[model samples]
Target: MKRNLLILITAAALLISGCATGPTVTRTASDEVIDLSGRWNDTDSRLTAEAMVSSMLSGGWLERFSTDEGRPPVVIVGSVRNKSSEHIDAETFIKDIERELINSGRVTFVAAGAARDELRDEREDQQSNATQSTAAALAAETGADYMMQGVITSQTDAIQGKRATLYKVDMELIGLENNQKVWIDTKEIKKLVEQKKNSW
Candidate 1:
């Protein structure tokens, strides 16, 4: 009788342990689109970058600048302010845009903000320790003719188990020397999620 009781308890403990374990995890491709939380995601960033860059390149801004200067215009990516309800990493989106811009070869991109500061620090370090010819010169950094800035805003609505979210990203290009607004654009994304409530 005691042996049977011990066997029953062991089985029950094993079952409870199995139940307490969390859900399984599986690795997927980085580019695969997966929407588990209905929040802004990698797919949204990539799509926005592609759309914005495509529009910017095909528009009159590049041609006009190249016509006037006879060379590709230099551009710097500035702060992309996130005024959304959820915490969003703006750098990932900005880097995506920068990558597309650089790959296009129509615009020259220069490091800005923290990246520029880090580069300057590295140069300073090299000036002290590295060989003279290998050390980079100060004040020789490329100047950006245009600065890109933007803001992201979001709205969310929920009713029972249904939820909807809308995200809007607005961007602008300004001439650094003349302080003129040269180009502006906006991209938007919407998501709908339906969840079932536990009835127990």
Candidate 2:
């Protein structure tokens, strides 16, 4: 019947309209600061790295090490543990610090952790595949004079659609030879987020 066809067509149109389409995405600059969820993000990582680098390079540790060693102190970036509630990629923060240190020319950096394993594997591969002249010598890699390690912790409080988070990042530089802690620093970031209750 004509009435049945009309109902069927109306239902199909409503179902099609209710279906969700693809997401809308907008590109932004890499360095531009943006916070959507009030959680940790690239801006936080970048700012923390900048603050840490500034504090570390301006401290007396680098000078004392260079004075005693007669060369820039070699550094290896160790683990940066994330102890926060939310999942965070600590590698990005660690890489940022390493990049700054290398660019500053204040210290030399050597690979650590998995990266060291990869480098060693490549050296082993070269032992048999390449000529002696072109192959890198084993046990000739520079040893780190110091190790940099740190942890990131966070606390959150929420009540009545309002929430606040505090993040603390603690870092230290330790001498590999004597196990002396040369430098220590902490950076803190706080954010507040609020939501409104539906009035409908």
Candidate 3:
């Protein structure tokens, strides 16, 4: 009986001590400070955009637009071919170009294939309903004067557990009416990563 009472008393004391200890608070590195030491996504995007802009300006596309006697340039983004092994969002890259072009206030963007298809279908349906006299007037018709397209290629080389990744993105703005190339740009990004073997 005495031993049972002592055990119970010890258990109660331990429980009380544990309760008084309260919840543990762990301290680690603050997430607010972003660590970009190894990551090059932001840098790569900026560099790619800058390179694209430089390529366009130096290629005389801007100069042509300014001097050539024609209507305002309306560029439509066409297919962006991805030749890389890994799946990538090519539309994001095209959108980046579109955004920069819009922000620059130099060019106009016509709806791409997807948007144009939807709009065409909508117009056809409206015309069938006969609510409007002509679909031409009912729909805003804007054919793309220039088509923007690109291709992304990737290369990998590994030796002795060290790997290198190279991505080359090339884009061009072609005159749709005359099939003439007006603007061309290419951006190359290379990265090296060391591989570590797992010991199990």
lDDT for predicted candidate 3 compared with the true structure: 0.72
Q: Say what the RMSD of model 3 is.
A: 7.1
What's the ranking of the predictions by TM-score, best on top? Answer: 2, 1, 3
Off by over 4 Å in 2: 1-20, 198-200
Tens-place lDDT digits, model 1, residues 51-158: 888877887888999999999999999999999999989999999999999999999999988989999999999999999999999889999999989999999988
Summed over model 1, clashes come to 0
For model 2, the run of ten residues with the poorest summed lDDT: 191-200
Error of 3 at 81 (Å): 0.5
Candidate 2, 1-34: lDDT as tens digits: 9999999999999999889588999998999989
Highest TM-score model number? 2
lDDT of each structure?
0.91, 0.92, 0.72
How high is each candidate's TM-score? Answer: 0.87, 0.88, 0.69
Q: What is the lDDT of residue 34 in candidate 3?
A: 35
Q: For model 1, what is the alpha-carbon lDDT of residue 119?
A: 97
Number of the top lDDT candidate = 2
